[model samples]
Target: MVDVNSLAALLPDGVVVTDPDILGGYRQDRAQDPEAGTPAALVRPANTEQVATVVRWAHERGVAIVPRGAGTGLSGGATAQDGALLLSTERMRDISVDPVTRTAVAQPGLLNAEVKAAVAEHGLWYPPDPSSFEICSIGGNAATNAGGLCCVKYGVTTDYVLGMEVVLADGTVVRLGGPRLKDSAGLSLTKLFVGSEGTLGIITELTLRLLPAQPPQSTVVASFATLEAACDAILAITGRLRPSMLEFMDSVAINAVEDQLRMGLDREAAALLVARSDAPGEHAGLEVAEIAALCEKAGATEVFATDDPAEGEAFTVARRVAIPALERKGPLLLEDVGVPLPKLGELVTGIAGIARRREVLVSVIAHAGDGNTHPLIVYNPADADESARAQQAFGEIMDLAIALGGTITGEHGVGRLKKAWLPNQVGPDVMALTRLIKSALDPQGILNPGAVL
Candidate 1:
């Protein structure tokens, strides 16, 4: 084992921490993986140079290094391991927005909401708006290639990422891509690391592309008596026009959100759809009116439209709080599964069937326009049999998604929780290629061991 005392001596004071209380907090991320192991020490690096120094020490000693960002990942990507060094980038928050170039250079530790606010001051927008944007770090966003509500129309993290500075396993720092809009460089290395989930390298800085401020949005809220009707409305809306945001929540999620927010949501509705349009001028209202019409045509139980931004925002906030709201019921086994747009209905219905068969409560909320769903499986941890059943249903849902020509994970990376089903979706050939790339980039295997590979 490496001497942590000597490691601490090498860095600045207070940079290395061995307090059991603090180390205990770093052992597991929000995923709460039961298998999370105790880390030897936690290191908070303030700059890329310090990060490289720590990586070099770990590389030399062949000690595993787990890179973490704000610890908000739904996947267990940042779970600590035995005898590993927990490298937290929470101290490296710095950002510079260049309105002239429409880009921002940000350190990894900046929160997504902080990045958005910084860029917005310059009349620019950072489009990727993950539900956890207020809490998640920008580095984690790039690490997972996270998508969100606006992604239905704008794009995900990789789309906004023009360049990044990454530290490889051997402590070599390299810069890939740049602020330019287009680049046909040697390889698409920037994108390769964007969603690597810290297995390939540790992201230190990102050069993000930004767009002009979004237009005022017109929102539409619709309720359906059945899930199929809501899905039909989603397909119709996406097919007719691209809405700025298209979200879905089932009866369980609606009730959960209502219980917390008391926003007067229709608890009797089987499913709810919240669609928004940010088109220029009167077109925004026109688009939402058209979407409301489609919902009504699809047999919606109730249809509501609002051009009032605050009222629309209240509904949007309700949709965003679904996960935490559902967690109040019991422990959750979250699944991020996605399918082709046409297969979305089958995916949701199949998950409901799995829930019934497994005897677990599954609440599904989705970025419906893009076909990515967050299936929150609620179960009582005190009951081992019930927990086991939830686990079984979780795997089965991923299997169903794979069978439906879909992916096991759409936005959230295949962290430890979903690692088992990755090969099933991508097949052996792609798995081999993935392993080959990982080995080539991290020959010492000291960077985020036992993650994707």
Candidate 2:
């Protein structure tokens, strides 16, 4: 066994922590894996060299290592392993914006919101805005390839990521991609590591591409009496034009949000749709009006549009807060399942069927434009049968998405929680290829063992 004192000697005084109390807090991430293992040590590295050193020590000792970002992952990607050293990037935050290149070089620990704010000083935007953007680290976003509200229009972290610096399992650093927008010079290694979920390597630094500030947006919020009506409107609005934001909430989710926000949301409505357009100038209003008309034609009981940023923001907040709103009822099993546009209605309906069959309270909130849905399955831990049903529903949702020719995970990477079903979704051949690559890159299996593969 590696001596605790020797590990402490490799890092700064406060950097290496072994207190059982402190280690307890680092054991599990947001997924709250009940089986999370206690790490032998926790190393909070403030830079790439520090991370590499920790990795080298663990690699040489054949000690497992779990790479963690902000511990905000819904999947168990950051969950600690028994007797392993947890390599946390939460202390590595440092950012330098190059306004000329329209990019920012950021350490992994910087919050996604901070990255946006830093680049926005030069009138730029980093568009991956996860609902947890305020709390999630840039490294976590890249690790999960996380998507959010603006992703419908701007794209996810992988799109904005021009380059990155990752520390491999052997503690050797590899720099992939760069400031150049178009780099076909290599095998797209940067893209490979973006969503590896800490299994392939630990991301230490990121080179993010930025865009000019987004235009002012016009927002529309509507409620329909039937799921069919809401889905029809989604088809109509999407078929006609692309909206910067297109989201949906089912009746269960609507009631949950209303119970919390009490914002006079239509409780009788079977579904709610929030749409926005970032078209510049007068075109923004024009798009909002068209969206309102689309909703009306699709049997909207109520249609509301706003040019007021605050009014628009209020609705966006409600949409982003939907998950937490539903979480108030019980512990949640969150499923990030997505399908092709045309198959979306089927996916939602199939999930509803599964919920009914399993007898679980499953509330769905979706980034409708991309057909990605977050089905919140509420359950009580004290009741074994109820918990079993919820787990069944969770797996059923992923199965349904797979049947619809969609991903088991749209944005959130498949961490340990979903790894069992990953092979079923991706097939054995792909799984073999994944294992082969992971073996080649991290032969010691020290980087985030039990995650992904």
Candidate 3:
């Protein structure tokens, strides 16, 4: 057993905590893996130096360290291991926005929404907006390479990350890249670590690129009588031109949101789409008009357009709240599977088939324009048979995605839960190369053990 007293003495008082009650809370992240083990100690570091101290002590002692952000990860990437030190970056909330350079230097603990708000004060915007932006930390977003509703036009987390500060396994603090938009000086080490899922190193500070504030977006809400029609509209819209936001919710998700917000969503519609266009002034209106025509041509049951920001945001909020709304039904086994745009319809239909064959309820919502789908499998854990079925469906969905030449995860990292399917997606050679890199960077495997590899 490691000596807690010696470790505690090296840091400020209360930085190293071993209380059982406190340790319990850090054992699992939002993945909530039942098998997650109790961490030996929980370390709350305020800055990069403090984080390095914890890493150095753990490296010398061969103690495993699990780096965690806001604990909002859907994958089990932040799940704690037995006898490991859970290093939470929650207290390191600090950010400096540089309006001149259109960038923001932020500590890892700041929430995603806070980062957006900070940059907004300078008449700038951060493009990556995960649905949990309000609760998920910027560190976690980068760790997972998160995406959002607007990612169809803007791109994901990696696109906006100009640089970052990382603490490696051996306690070495390295700075990679910087605020410069273009840097070809070295290997793209910065991009490599962006979605490494804490297996490569712990991110301390990130220099994020910012854009001028977004223009007022015109919104289009379309309802379809069948899932197939909604998917047709998605492809048609994306094929024509890029939209600021394009989102999809099936009947399960639509009714779920309606149940919670009483927003008067078409509860009887088989599918709903919330699309947006942020082109300059009149162009925004023209884009939505074109989108509405495409939806109507694609067999939409009803289509509504609005230039009012408040009205548009209300629908965006409805799509964003689908997860929590469905959670009210039962515990969920979430699967993030994405396929090529052409295969979107096939994947959606295949998932429905899986739910029926497995005798489980699965609700799917997606950043439809980008072809990434989140299928929520609702099952009662109290039932042994139902729980087993849900687990089977989870693996099957990933298998289906692979069959269609798609990835196991789009934005969410392969954390522990989805690591099993990673090799299937990436062939043996890539897996071998991944292992080699992991071994070279973390020979002792002290950093985020059992993740990715």
Candidate 4:
């Protein structure tokens, strides 16, 4: 067994926690992998130096370290391992927003929402909004290169990340990039660690690029009698104008969300599309009007357009709550597969076919504008057969995505859960390059062992 007493002696009194009950909470992230292991101890560091100290200690002792943020990751990126040091960055919450440069140098532990709010106070916005932004950490966002609704128009986390302060595997802290908007300096190494999922190094601080607050948005909610019609509308809308947000939900996801929100969603529709336009001034309304027209041409059963922010936000909330709403039925095997825009319809239909063939209830929700989808496969873990089928369908979905010229995961990182399929997606050459980079940075393989690799 690992010596917890020695680790305790190096940090503050309460920094190293070995209490079984407390460690239990840190075992798994939102993915809730059944294979999650019991951690030897949990370390909470308040500053970069404290983090480096913990890493140095662990490196010397040859103890594997798992760097974690708020643990809201949906890909099991932060799952704990047996006899490993669980390094929690929760206590490293600190931020300094530079209004002049429109950049914020924030510690990894700050929640994504907290970063947005802090920047908003200075009339700026940080727009890489994962669905769990309110609960996920900025460090975790950077770690996973998370994407969200606004990403259809804005961009992913890597786009907003100007620079960061990361700790190498051997406890060496190095600063990469900065508040500068344009810097072609030195191999773009800052971005290399952004989505490394802790296999490269531990991110202690992030310098995030920000923008001025968003403009008023116009919303469009359309319901289709068939999934094909919805896809047609998606193609039509994207082929024409750039929408601020374009999201889709199939019959299963629509009913599931409606069951929870009771917001008078169209239950009879086979699919729902909630889109928005954040163009300046009256142009927002014009954009929504054109989108509504496209929905009609695509055989929409009903169409609703709104310029009121409150009304639009309500629809957005319903889309965001889809995963939780579906979880009410049973445990979920979530799949984040994405394809090229033109191939999206084929991907969605293929997933439905997989669900039917596997005899499982798979709900499809997506950032349709970008062709990234989340297929939620519901199953009862107590039922061995059903669980096995769910697992099979999960792999099949990734396979289908790969065949469709897409990725196994879009915004979510290739954590422990998705690592198996990653080799199939990126092929042998890319995988070898990845290993070379990982080895050069973490030769001991002590940082987040068994993850991404």
Clashes of each: 0, 0, 0, 0
Model 3 per-residue lDDT tens digits across residues 1-453: 667788899999999999998888888888788879888899999999999999999999999999999998888999999989999999999999999999999999999999999999999999999889999999999998999889999999999999999999999999999999999997999999999999989999999999999999889999999999999999999999899999999999999999999989999999999999999978887899999999999999999999999999999999999999999998999878999999999999999999999999999999999999999999999999999999999999999999999999999889999999999999999999999999999999999998887
lDDT of 2 by residue, 1-453 (tens): 446677778888888898899999999998888879989988998999988888888888899999888898898889999999988889988999998899899999999999989999999999999988999999999999999987777888899999999999998999999898888996999999989999898999999999999888889999999888888999899899889999999999999999999999999999999999999988898899999999999999999999998989999999988988888998999889989889888988888899899999999899998888898899998999999898888888998899999988988889999998898888999999999999999998888899987
Misplaced by over 4 Å in model 3 are none
lDDT of 4 at 402: 100
Model 1, span 184-271: residue lDDT tens: 9789999999999999999999999999999889899999999999999999999999999999999999999999999999999999
Over 4 Å off in model 4, which ranges? none
lDDT of 4 by residue, 345-415 (tens): 99999999999999999999999999999999999999999999999999999999999999999988889
lDDT, residue 428, model 1:
99
- The lowest-lDDT stretch of 10 consecutive residues in candidate 2 is 1-10
Model 3 lDDT on a 0 to 1 scale = 0.94
Residue 252's lDDT within candidate 4 is 93
Displacement of residue 195 (Cα, Å) in model 4 is: 0.7
Off by over 4 Å in 1: none
Which pairs of residues have clashing backbones in candidate 1? none
- lDDT of every model, 2 decimals: 0.94, 0.91, 0.94, 0.94
RMSD of each: 0.7, 1.0, 0.6, 0.7
Instruction: Please state the error at residue 71 of candidate 3 in Å.
Output: 0.4
TM-score of 1: 0.99
For model 4 the local lDDT of residue 396 reads 98
Shift in Å, residue 62, candidate 3: 0.8
